[model samples]
Target: MAARTVSFGIGFRVGGSLSLLALLAACSEPLDLDMRGLMNGGFNTADAARASTAPRPAADNRGVISYPNYQVAVARRGDTLAALAARVGLPADELARYNGVQSGDTLRAGEIIALPRRVSEPSPATGATTTGPIRPSSQIDITTLANDAIERSAPTPAAQRPTPQVGTEPIRHQVERGETAFTISRLYNVSVRSLSEWNSLDSNFSVREGQYLLIPVVTQAPAPREVAPIEPGRGSPTPQPPSASQPLPTETPAAAAATTQAATAAAAAAPPVANVGTQTAASASNAAMAFPVQGSIIREYSKGRNDGIDIAASVGTTVKAAASGQVAAITRNTDGINILVIRHPDNLLTVYTHVDNITVAKGDAVSRGQSIAKVADFEPARVHFEVRKGFDSVDPMTYLR
Candidate 1:
């Protein structure tokens, strides 16, 4: 029997092979699926680098995001604790201890690290170049957005916002007529470089009238260390008491008795001597400053949280000076709340905030318990009062009567 030879077309075979390959590819897992560090839990450096490139939560201009109770910093790719600390103007060891990490340890990009305390906020002087911090309370209101054309545009990505320095929420300053950046920085006790960086100022630092600027955050400088008081008899040399080197003639029994009786009688008749040290201490106690407001304290002093005490009072209640002093500064916060700073003797300062209807002006001499301002009509109608020694905040209760 003769067999018929069947020829297979080259194109058909090639097409069939291609179809098979396509089917296999469709059924197989995606090439983009990453199963890295799955088998041995040992990730290669290349894999780590790639993973770090993933998007991290956005930080403010200063790479900080502050919550009501705490603040955190978002790490950039290839960041280490030491590098981050230097960038934020914090001690590397301190930052490491706060996050339970070593200063040299590399951090995953976008990892959130807690801060020990606040560092400075976005300052061009410090050379920080990230967008400003995220503060929900500080966000522009809906009404303002509806009215302003610029704010109505699509929200800017966090990376593109003005850079922030590590600190508290920034003060939003509306440019006033004839106001310059230098004057504004002086007003807030910050550097002009900081102001320019925070608001993204022009090369000339020129500000237009009616423009809005973010005032750089400022933290009080650390108080100078105090020298402890010397212990009694330890400060200086004292004359030694009479020694037994010289002996006195012995007295007869009757004479000794008479002399003792006379001494006793004289001692009994003499008036008591007041201790100078005791009197000075008592005077200081009596001189404690009076409370700013007569009301229950709604909030107590908490370092890094509440620097002062909040006293609940009726609106228009007189807020008195905590101590006798000259009004050093009469300013307003970004929230439009009045802040009065008084400079007392011995480097003491008293602060009164959330006030309205200020009756006193800067450089005015005020006596303790004299009215300086009135409590504003805030929701709680409270006055926030603080006592500061130098630049450091101290517990008001320590000085309050």
Candidate 2:
């Protein structure tokens, strides 16, 4: 192939210079070079050389300044979108839509203000990795710019992640050969009635082989109130008017203690509610499941009484298991000829149906992102996930988090 050559206008203009500066900042992008270079030839050679030497982006690998065309950054604490737009030569409304923020909203520092016709970014994965090109408002000074725009003193993401709530503690008890639920209840100083309810088993107390159970010590719940019929001549007492300062009665110390204990036990015995996602053991595959794709959640789960939920994804997109699990059942429904089912360690089942091809076999264990299948049928295919306990379908949204 002949050597490629570029052309530029001899007389450079100021408008072309700033845009060229942005292009030079994002020289890695081919389209950026062609577009910005057309306007860049007139820039002062000295200034262009100076900018090339001092380049250090604070956002680990996020080169916000590289894509200068569409963005202006928040410089200091409390800078409004209007003010930032004035500096970057864009409308305040444009900035608002870029960051999904409002015009009157206060920016912290180092935020990007996406301007029109900004430089494009190379796909770094397969193409060039220009920092400046094609950045949106969300990617401005994208590193520190986005973070600093709110507060230099803002909490680090790890700090911002909500603290894990204190979930139910694992209760433990050894199984005695001859002991029944009655015997264990007496030994633990807990009521048999409470024990049956704590465990999801029937009240028959049919103890099984060598299973260790967690005994939750719960207080006896008060009997529900009942309405009694009165004789024809009897009358009910009149209700008293409410008074803000009136005090409430205090339960006896013994009753109060019992209530507290029962509450603690009940809390300990409860199971985590059903969710769209399921928890799994620590593994590389389990962690990889947090991201379904690079796009969005176009469809949702359980809109009706359906077996599973669907996630609309691009056709031919790679499908992954929700978490690490044993391959439970693989079936080709009459309608959906291509289907895959994985049973995670947590007993959660994720089904990838309507697939173009199945890469896994029935009973073949798979991992998250293991490329078990692909969406071959339509423009965007869906992966149907159904989490179950035994055969009971549970809501999956609760666990996706």
Candidate 3:
């Protein structure tokens, strides 16, 4: 009876262990929860199946968006002004100017670039139109756009008139040994006319050593003008000729003879005017000519070949007018280099090329040695200067002092 009880106990323990293992195996299986149907309301097999099969939109690589008025471009990594301009079909310089950035500057990744909605407005002076990728107006700062428009539309001041300013005082400078009016004007960064006017001296007056001269400070205030008093209800009457009764005042015979002799001597001492042909032949013979820029000549003019001389100069160097003249043309070349052509007395035209940041415009009257433009970056970094008589080019060295 005891042996039979032990066998039954071992069999019970083994069956219990097998039962526990089977329970654990059942618990390990996935629950297969109906999430979509439960969130909607209860378990609906059809709704859960539809939720799992729906399609979604793919991601975009351009990272750009289109709006009703304007489009925007998101800058990518390693982008430059030139690259952006080329991508958008706009000129690199124009693009830089529009964004108030330099053409050689780099653009930051993820930066917003403002583009024109439609075609850009044509430049009034050049009549050139811009074509490129468009940007929305909302992306650009309104104030910056307005300021740029104002600057482009504002009229340029006359070259002969100095820009006016208030509360300006005269600059006093003491004349040094061997300093002439030209040198003093240059030292003070002033025009010779301003120097003469401030000191009450004539244009031909010579500066003496140890003398103090007052240099006029340029101001925005317009110079005062003298207006004659008008008669009541009409302008001033023209002066009437003296009556015949007042015989023309006559000088003494001895004095008149001496004046006549002096006049004859003065006329004899003056140089004769050259004929048109002679003037053309000797066009490059002005002794008072000034150098446009202080630099060594890299390329000299050769007959039947090069028409101008190239002077080696550092970028951004100030370039002055070789002689006083009226600016006939201020334009850019195909490569966007600035060119200035001035028409001087005696039918002479001086050409300055490869320049940027020009100070004068067309029809401006510039003085000799006046700053006109700054040297621009070119392959060789030089200025091409030409002295021309109508269509004939001459050697600048023959005329430059």
Candidate 4:
């Protein structure tokens, strides 16, 4: 009887252990995070499921959703366009018109309402990445030029105008997670060896996250100055007649002879400025394209990293077309930022991003310098401009006047 009892107890214990293990196995079945959409970019059953979810960025305290290319606000349950606009500090009618909805129309929860313009940037309080472009401290703020010009009515002479020159010092960069020495060097288009020497990196050239390193300096030659040649007769200044305010002297033989001699002497002397041409050159060159907006270039183009240049302007500044072309496409990125592409001759294309209030539609004919849109209201208020020849992007400065 004792042996039988011991056997029964062991069997019970084994059975209980098996039940527990089964429970654990059931609980450990892979969690359905619904992350398949992110893992695949192509359309499939997962994409349809993800679309129903309508995942969107969470709004901050200001009710603004911030993205690199654009921003949006999510609608709450039982909310109207007007209510959402008020919560986000935007005009109700403007918001409604931009989204193609009535002010009083009810919105579905989690529905995205694209912002016509940027409201604010992600704050540090939210723990969002607030990294900006790395620039040398010696770089001058370009807005100063506009401010100085506004303060004075007369245009400053080119010779007297202060030209902002880039300094030779290395730019300081804070290493972010996943950044390597080689990547940093590639970002600034400098050799890794120079970057290591400037920052005094160890033999391994390892950089830790949150560590600050100086970017290597690159010696760049000054661009050739474009001087509009003076035409042969155009350079000569025309003499003005005596003003009516001044009375002419009485006619006298001696005074007339003196005036004649003085006039002859002046004519014999070289003109204060020479007119080297009858008309300015109308021939087009590589630099025939006009700037999309009048602002300082905050960031220059890098082939892979930055495919275009960033020009910082006011929020409502007019953005003009770079060249005469037909509007090939007007679309939005994943972030809903407006992108305008114009198809020019020679199979070239010009792209304008971070702009709002688009005045032209797709397939519309646009002329050079035509107002196509306005700069978006971003924190820095900048426009991303690019010039593309076929599939590759080239230096915008090479073609910008």
RMSD of each: 25.2, 34.5, 36.0, 30.2
lDDT of 1 by residue, 1-401 (tens): 12322234666778899996896687422221233433485432222112211112235554665544555676677899898888777899988876666899986665556677876553344344543333333222211221132222224422233422333455556678767766565466555555655554556777766554555554443234488988899968899888799887576689789999999999999997653211111114475788777766778887555767888878998888878888777666457766677888897778787888899977789997788888899998888887877556798878864
Across 69-158, the per-residue lDDT of candidate 4 in tens digits comes to 445666677888899998878999988777666899886665556677876554544333332222232122221222233223223422
Could you give candidate 2's per-residue lDDT for residues 145-203 as a string of tens digits?
21222222223422221111111222345465777765565455454444444443343
Give lDDT per model, in order. 0.62, 0.47, 0.57, 0.63
The TM-score ranking, best first, is: 1, 4, 3, 2
Model 1 poorest ten-residue lDDT run = 47-56
Question: Tens-digit lDDT track for model 3 on 1-401?
Answer: 89999999999899989996786677532222223323546532322112211111111233232222333444567888777666655677876665556778776664444444432322222122221222222212221222233233336522231111112224446677777765665455455555554454533646666555555454333333478887686866778888998887676689889999999999999997633211212124456467777666777786323567787778999989989988877655444666678878886778888889899987789999899999999877888888877546788777874
Of the candidates numbered 1 and 2, which has the greater lDDT value? 1
lDDT of model 2 at position 110: 44
Model 2: how far is 289 from its true place, Å?
Answer: 4.8
In the predicted model 3, the residue pairs found to clash are 115-135, 116-135, 164-219, 164-220, 164-221, 165-219, 165-220
Which model, 1 or 3, shows the larger TM-score? Answer: 1
Q: Which candidate number has the best lDDT?
A: 4
